[model samples]
Target: FEALHAAVAGLPVSGSRVLPGLVLRRDFAAYCPASGELAAVVVTESLHPALSAPGVEFVVGSEGQYQASLRWCTRRTEAVMKRLQSSNVKLLLSSVKQQEVVIYYAKLYGVSVVECLSSEEIALICEITGVSPCTPFGDNGEITETAVATFCQPLLLGSKRYVHVGFTSVCAFQPHCLILCGPVDGVNEQHAAALQGAFTMLQQLFKTVDQ
Candidate 1:
């Protein structure tokens, strides 16, 4: 709590800024049956904080490759997939071992499947980015395609655990949102300034608080 408070208070008044970004992937989608709409109750308790940041954005679409011939594409699906593959989509699709087949297929279409991070890594990403990290409190293994049904457990009539972090809720974590800091082209000056400022503020805050 003290650290969080300090980081915010010590934010740089002025300096070059570096935009920090985070990509969160979960295998929950693969846990559902191959066909039809399946439901799962992934606990968002951890992700609530990070997804709540200002400027944080969410894009939902196909996560894998686009092998379907252009002729087969419906305008709606095509439009949605385009958004999912946009340069702004930093967080990678998260899935478990069972979904490797689907993931492989997704890769064939140009999707970049990032291996699921462990709980600790997840925590680190959230802490460093000032986003709230959500961890599954239940014990489970990397899911496979066949066993994906296990992830679709129904929520009780009055329960809310099955809910996903709403789209609007996830996009709010902007200022602290992890900016994509990778070898990409066309990054603007404002992004660089944001990143630099975030780091500089953090450093100065640490020094002052240590005393």
Candidate 2:
């Protein structure tokens, strides 16, 4: 990570704004899609397992399941939501249900939620916005001031328009780079091909150097 930081810093920039380091927080967790069970309970400085026991499982069609789910969700979400609600920066999730109960709570808290993003997209958004993506229901290390100057506007090429969004935070998995390109005209393949070629070349160069 330090070497990558040095390399990025060594790159020449045409403007006066120092290129922010592609530095991710040391506390970021590893990606584990199947680890949902591991996060069923969120322990924080203020919230801990000692405060409550796991709820008893009830049979289907009974209110037990709903009550348990809601209790778990609220306890888990509240831990992080309270911290984020007071923050001035925007929040982006890789994917979230518009009708999810969490969304309703998030709205109530005045949190701005951008959903349906992929992990890569979230990382890209972080790079452009300089906001770290925090783990849901987990500790948010330190909320830094938003990098207002780092915002990027949508790129329009002919008929296709591309938007960049990110999820950057102290708990992001790692720093990443992403470039999204699509045809403005539904039939235009040339632009997409060119962009893909450039991306591939860049990847190959990086891999070669790493080797």
Task: Write down the TM-score of every candidate.
Answer: 0.24, 0.41
Candidate 2 colliding pairs? 125-165, 125-166, 126-166, 131-168, 132-168, 132-169, 133-168, 133-169, 159-184, 160-184
Tell me the TM-score of model 2. 0.41
Over 39-124, each residue of candidate 1 has an lDDT whose tens digit, in order, gives 11112232112212468664435433333322233332333223333422212323233134434333433433334445654343
Q: How many Å off is the CA of 132 in candidate 2?
A: 5.5
Give the total clashing residue pairs for model 1: 45
Off by over 4 Å in 1: 1-83, 90-95, 131-211
Best by lDDT: 2
Candidate of highest TM-score: 2
lDDT, model 2: 0.38
Q: How well is each residue in 86-197 modelled by candidate 2, as lDDT tens digits?
A: 5543332333233354555556554444444445544444554455544443354444434332232233323333332222334444444322223233322443455567
Q: State each model's CA lDDT, in order.
A: 0.31, 0.38
